[model samples]
Target: MSERVLIPRNRGFLFLDSHPAGCERLVTDMWQACPGSADMPEGDGPVALIIGSSAGYGLAATLAGLKRAGIRGIMVSFEKAPTERRTGTAGWYRTAATADIARAAGRDLVFLNGDAFSDTMKNQVADLIEQRFGGRLDYLIYSVAAPRRTDPATGTTYASVLKPIGRANRTKTLVFDGEGVPEVREVETGPAEGDDVEQTVAVMGGTDWERWIDQLVGRGLLADGFATAALSYIGSPLTAAIYRQGTIGTAKAHLEATARSLNERLGRTVGGRAVTSVNGAAVTQSSTAIPGIALYTGLLRGVLGEDLVPPVHQLAALWDQLTGAAPSDLDDEGRIRLDTWELTDDVQAAVAERWEAATTDSIADLADLAWFRSEVQRLYGFSVPGIDYAAAVATDIPWPDHTA
Candidate 1:
């Protein structure tokens, strides 16, 4: 392998490249940030699988499961591999770093790279479970985020849209030029046209999750007492027009409905269950691309301050819930409400006030804009504090030991 210096460059709001050492630093930082499972009443024989276990909440949940639960784990994600001319995805580096840490610690972990929405990927994971997990899985997490999905039955590709449902959406948003300061502007988006909501649901919703469950059940891959969680987000009213009550929200509603249906079916058939873990907002690849989400999350961080529950912490707590340490804080809809901190009366009042008064000059004061930008870069392994960007490091880190 050849070594090269990684200089971070921003293409629009996304990073053009990722640093391997920086990604390793980030994984190490997350390992330290997560709560240890020393006091928890943990159950044994946990063979866990995270469907989108390379970045964002999936990666966080994977870390929580590994460090706290010490379970045999399998990860599934789709990311481009690195070539001689360019670095691969941040997820590729993150997964490589995760595998490195797991190996050093003697942890049981596996990684598979492929389109998770496809039946082929499901079959491959089933085969892995049979070969590596004694033919049964105890825990499953559905946390995939994608721009589009091709239906296996019909081979129709559906692309998700982030538009409002009923009326035009006009909201305050930020545009980063990768310079000294960001420009805050008003963005107007039209409502979802014909088939937009359906397409969004097909890409971002829970049909794939249900399909995974059905396929695993059909193969007898899920163990008795199996539990699965699908991560969901119902954003604040600040971005509600474009998020919670919009096309994406419609898709999330479908996801919640699928969870309810799957929960009942799993309970009836295998004495198992499924639930949607409604998590707090954080800087993730999926959330950063949404128009108004940047402004909303910045204000959320500003108002909540130290009180804000980071996504990894929320996921670690979810692990505690799944492993019998704590009971779930479920809502009337039977969904685990991990977003209570973000939805509190005081927090919302402050965030709304900040949102209303925000402008190009005042937005930074109203929200942690610098931190938000840093976080976005950190996701792609660029803005990590300790990594030496000037030093040359190997970019072609091989994928973890697993079938791709």
Candidate 2:
């Protein structure tokens, strides 16, 4: 893959096919960003399974967990195509790079290429776990992100529609890159509420998570005391309606509810536990498309550093807690609001204060600009310490071979 032009503030969207060394360098930087030090855990047999194990924080959490614990396991991912309309490819390049890093670290890695939503894929995963790990797994992580899914049994596909809630929402958001913020008006001229809500739930919420867990248990493949978790997000109230209260919010609610149900069901066999991590906002490919979040994220970047814990950091912290290395930072419901650092009353209050005071005339200042750039760089495998961007990138690295 050829190197892409790097924009000053929008490096987060660079989306390069990073080389093995570059990927490992960033992984190490993020590993140090966590609190405390723990040896990589040593054990065997399906120690961990990460669904949606390809990009963004999903990939980060997997690497961090493995690095910290020194555990090895399988990764089942439904990799998505890059937004550039890359033809006939779905993130194999990334999987290959990550595999190279894992092998170098003396960690065992397995990458299964298939849809996690289908029975064929689900059964395939169960067989792999059962055969390789003695029908038991210590950890299961659900981190897939997509717009929609077609239910194999129901023959109905679930999808999402982005729109305004409550009185024609008019808001300002960051533009294409992180350079500037712009005013936007969200209009809802699409489907009706019932249709949209159902579709959103079907596409983005807990059903798939529940199905995967159920399949594992029924196949007698889950080991005792297995722990499972799914990632969720609840931004500030300003953006909550668009994120947490709209179609996506409805899906998250279902996801949270699913966690409760799964925890109950897994009580005996594996002491099944369900956790929801309300992560902070980052400059991910998906978050950049959301309305009104960029400005808030930018504001957060300025205030959060120097003892600041963003979403990715929180994810690493939470992974540590899950693996029995640290205590949890959970709320009353046992679900951790990891995003609290960015959503704190003080933090949100400060950002809201900035929002109201900001106009097209008075946009973000140098502080905000600096924060935006740093956070943006952190998103796309850059700006993190110890990574040499000048390193050569290779796209032909070998993918993990579980069969061998």
Candidate 3:
């Protein structure tokens, strides 16, 4: 096994082997909170399909569906397999670990590894639903985060940009040195160009989500009263210039618009509904890639205190919304605001105050950078409790038979 090393100053961790015990602990927590858990609502869970289900919110939703909602899951993701040089992406290990646990409990889970944006992957999932889950899925969860997307028809690839929409915004960005010491630097991001908005939208917007729904409907893979949700995020005003009002935000707006259209169409056609879910920020592989988000997350978590919800807890809240245990609290645009707690007036106010006062010297005291760093490591199956990090393990574990 390759040696596991932590990047300096809390950037992240690197290793070739996943901690089996860590994976088990993570999934076990998810399972214990699942539908059958004492706190969950009782009912027969729906048959569900999730795109981008290997990591982040998608993984949480998948686990919530299986454990809390008691549903059979069909998960799709684009992830690397284990190779001689490195272990597979954390999602690969997570899926494998979760599958073993689910099967032991007599649950059904299917993981399809490939590009979810392609027609080929969509068709494969449709077929799998028919073959394995008796032809219909009750829930479709779209939680993919990609930097670029290839158009299925024209084969043109569009990449997403993370620039502000107007003039450049310079702000104090934080980074950890190789030794784990925090340093603050002023980072400037320029405005988006003429085609940047369009390109970003084309890559990250709801176009593919709509296509997936349309194809599934056309193929009769959706059950009556089916529901679909795609994840989005709206940050606080502190980072609005770069995040909420930026190029990616334009794409998110398009996504919400598509959700509105799909909701009406699905309601009219199949008595189903579709909605966009605005989720709270958390540490994930995707979010870590976005500039300024890490600092924002740390500040937000510090302000929110223990009330902050992680991805798993957020998915639990979503399950509550879907199962009618909790109210949907639909916005005027017909979207669901799962970030309700995070966006509370008190929380934003506190974060805003810290945002203004934050500096290299003050950040460590004002924000939860410790928590942020630990979570980043956790995402990669590192720094987890109960794992013998020194143990020798194989990098190339075979995919479960169902996934294979």
Residue pairs in clash, model 2 = 40-68, 40-69, 40-70, 41-69, 41-70, 136-223, 225-270, 244-249, 266-272
- Candidate 3 clashes: the total is 6
Candidate 2 segments whose C-alpha is farther than 4 A from its true place:
1-25, 32-39, 80-93, 165-167, 177-194, 370-393
TM-score of each model, paired residue for residue: 0.96, 0.84, 0.92
Ranking by TM-score: 1, 3, 2
Q: Give a tens-digit lDDT track for model 2, residues 1-404.
A: 63343222334345443333444555555555544444544554237888887766677666666666665677877753433323112245456556766777667777888887888888887887777666677788888888778898887777776654443455666543344343333323332365787787887789999898888878877767778889888888878657777777888889999988888878855776878877777766677767677766765665565545644467677777787767878888778777776766887777777776655445655126655655555545445556555654433444557777
Instruction: Estimate the overall C-alpha local distance difference test score of candidate 3.
Output: 0.80
Candidate 1 lDDT over 1-404, as tens digits, reads 87999887877667778888898899888877988842322443389999999999999998888776776668999998889888989999999888877666566789999999999999988998999778989999999989999999899999999999889989888787756478789989998999999999999988999999989999999888899999999978888888889988988999999999999999998898899999998989899888888888888988877777877899988988887779988999999988998898888899899988999988878898778888888998988998888999998988897643
| Model 3: per-residue Cα lDDT over 1-404, one tens digit each | 44443221233333344554455566666666554463323453578888998788998888777666777768888878877656676787788877876676566778888999999998898998898888988999999999999989899999999999979988766678777787767899999998999999998899999999989988988898898999889877777888889998999999999999999999998898999988988888888776778888889888876788777878877877876668897888887887888778988899888878888889998889888777777776666766666665555655667844
Itemize residue pairs with steric clashes in candidate 3: 8-178, 9-180, 34-67, 34-68, 35-67, 35-68
Q: Candidate 2 — worst ten consecutive residues by lDDT sum? A: 81-90
Query: Which of 1 and 3 is ahead in lDDT?
Result: 1
The superposed Cα distance between candidate 1 and the true structure at residue 169, in angstroms, equals 0.5
**Model 1 stretches astray by more than 4 angstroms:** 37-45
